[model samples]
Target: MLNLNQDPQIILWALTKDTYWHPDDHWQAVDRRCKELSTGEIFAVIDDIVHHFVHAPVVILTGKNVWQREDFDQILGKMAPILPSAIALNNPRLSHAALLSRWKDLGLTSVYLRLQNPRTLHGRQTVALAEAVVDHGMRLEIMTAVTPRTLPWLPGLADLMLSVGAASWQLGFNESLQRSKLDAKTLEQTLVWVADFAATSPLRVLPIGAPQYQRIVSDRYPLLDAGRIALREARGIAYINHHGLVYPGVNLPFAGGNLRQSSFSNIYRESPTFCALRDPRPLEGRCGFCDYHLTCGGSRTRAFRETGKLYAEDPGCWNPQTA
Candidate 1:
């Protein structure tokens, strides 16, 4: 029953993600697990869209510099034949990208570049890199962090994304304690701008996390069913840290299970903590009463961040009751 066809999301820890990769025996075991997962020896079927399997298998490298680091390059080279992971690289040296030539041969189907402000120097490099990714016949995406300073630039950024032919774009607000300091007006303004821009733009632009939760609760966005939302975060998504600690999402305090203790497919399907997060009946506040409550219960991570409980409604939501 540990089949990956049901839910497939893999975040392969890279050396660049704050964790050191030592070539020790434990490291060898981790590598072996990765190979098995990549080669389908660990599960019945891995739903990878790159291989045209199903609606899942969005495997990401979880860090940048994969192209620059020799260790990652060696590991990726070995798994390239069967795995074909899509990489998300941060601030890349786009000018000297001879690596693009090997992308197809190495089974790298797409590249997602995370850019900050479009007006900044690093942002310009992002656009150039996006164009290069497209020219290489690989899919490209642009993800920008939304801060108070970065808010006003999104309109121009949307145009830039369209110009570069990126497949999608995301405006991800900070999810940590900084969210508390963020002006509510700025957050709402950013949401409205994204809602309006997405309506007009051919490029797929989306607001992530709390902004998105706001949209769903305020009837600006579609309400997802419990099953869909459950699979998406409560169960479907997996953020395995460099040490292979599997959490429901990024920077979460708890782990559903560790990949070292069980097969990834098994842990994703049957972890008690993850399963508890899926129950939609006991959702609190206005989120529990709204018919869409099952789908849009607000940001559970933000709930935990603000209220110390994942089941608590999001404090970031304008209505303390609505979140």
Candidate 2:
């Protein structure tokens, strides 16, 4: 009764917790004191990965100061024996050349950094980290939150992204902070602008939580073969918190199961929440009847955040149509 073949290609493992600063609180882990995964716990996860996906999925080790643990480099060394890894760090202090060189030596392929508000000095530091990541022969992926305060930074942000040689950029709305949230019209316009910008730039521009990006890109450039334009959340993208609880996406708080409690494959294949999310036929409102339901299932997390129902229509989608 379920399709067990939808294996995840990427997993964000938050092995540590830091103080949360971004409006999208569920998205980033930094600046706070919290529990961290132990060496044994981490290896169990790695072991599960080996036996789970058809091919090894990219694992992103993220949190405040992951290197704070003295055993972190050793952890990297252990993971190297099994799978290559990357890390997402937000601390400016940890972006120095020496540490980055060590990360490269450990077989890290990329670095993920966040730039919440690029106007401040901290924003510049975030950009500097991006440059450092590129200088060290590693891929750089920059993620930023889209708030009313950050919307105007688009042009300047694009310029900085080019200067830093970033490989990809992920932009998501600040769904946590009420005052900073974008209206439906503004969200649609922003996605369209990003879609147009992505067409000419070498950078992969992904609207983190906005599934409407798929419909916008397809409708705008119906002639070009743009490939798949959807958020790969429940459809093969997942997140795991420090406690080993697996989620459909970084922003999607619904957990499939805990790695310590069960095998990763079982949770992914049998979780009701996961199964429902992957099958968009039961989606309600505009999303259910939309032509792009297969590709753009809409943001189920955003729907749950606003309407208290997982199957509700995405508030950010502007398509006023029905089947």
Candidate 3:
């Protein structure tokens, strides 16, 4: 079990497609989910999960550009009906000052800007925006889609730096590799570059998805052990679409396809090393010395679908001794 002094600090939900979907349809789904959940229930669940995982705050990211103040206000108004705890503005086309002003007015706690593909700004402009965010006193997060070759030259300006895709993973599973059809060595090089960048930066590095997490934990854990990168400082955050399944505490599975075939259960199962020990009953397993048990409950739906039992032995359990 991991010994964590602090609780999980943040719970960010990527409400990406909502910006592209029709507002009413998007809201209806959200309303239905929250209909039976009282304010106290909602807060309790959120707090419990956050506390268990040591997460600090919760935020929602809208994957769209806000071009004007009115556009920002409109998005906030629409968001108000849903009453999300926080908001992350992604790829805003507006100037830094304008975006910051609007975010402040909306009472947003955090804002994430993508440094990977800046359509409107150059490197200098990106640096200026980071400066403006610090000036405005808004919590800042940065997303990078650059490889090691390109990243070193870019200014180190973000508080939290997120690798947008599987740049740190092995070749076959990396979407970028599939797009470029690169070899394994090239993929390894890119992962090394990411590690090198993280080694130099004080900002936290987050892997984008589950594949990246698998590769990092399996292949790159050695690199971390060698002190080439800080595994403790590196984290993972997944983006789930509407089809994704929600596990009460761990993560919302959104890898694609039916939840059953996604390996959600295999990767996160109830065991001494895997289950959230604090809440073992929910998972119906014993995992000793696992500090993350309560905070990192196994994927509930995945276990159900894989084993045909809601709270039974996790078919995905890999560590037989613990099982």
- lDDT, candidates in the order shown: 0.59, 0.74, 0.39
lDDT of 2: 0.74
User: After superposition, which runs of candidate 2 have C-alpha atoms over 4 Å from their true positions?
Assistant: 1-5, 18-35, 80-84, 176-179, 223-229, 320-323
Ranking according to TM-score, highest score first: 2, 1, 3
Ranking by lDDT: 2, 1, 3
Off by over 4 Å in 1: 1-16, 19-54, 68-84, 177-180, 211-232, 319-323
TM accuracy, model 2: 0.87
Q: Tell me each candidate's TM-score.
A: 0.76, 0.87, 0.45
Model 1 lDDT tens row, 1-323 = 22332455444444344332322466446544652222232122222223443344566675435555555555455555566467777666566356776865677777878887756787777777788888988878788878766666777777788888898886766554364366555566566667666666777665656533434324554432123342235444666555456666664556677555665555656787667666667667655665555555656777676677777765555542343
Q: Over the stretch 1-323, how does candidate 3's per-residue lDDT look in tens digits? A: 33322222233443333343222455447634632322333334434443345333343544333233234455454443333344444544346567577666676655565555333356446646755766677665665544544344344323223222111211112223333343335444545555555665555555442122233333445555432211111122222232233222222222222222333222223222223322346556632233333333333433444455445433332332343
Q: Please provide, for model 2 over 189-244, each residue's C-alpha lDDT reduced to its tens digit, 9 standing for 90 to 100.
A: 89889989988898878777777788888888876535564755677678777766
Backbone clashes in model 1 = 0
Highest TM-score, which number? 2
Residue-pair clash count for candidate 3: 17
- Off by more than 4 A, model 3: 1-11, 16-60, 65-87, 105-107, 117-126, 147-176, 180-182, 207-323
lDDT of 1: 0.59
Candidate 2 residue 189 C-alpha distance from true site, Å: 0.5
C-alpha RMSD for every candidate: 6.1, 4.0, 10.9
Of candidates 3 and 1, the better by TM-score: 1
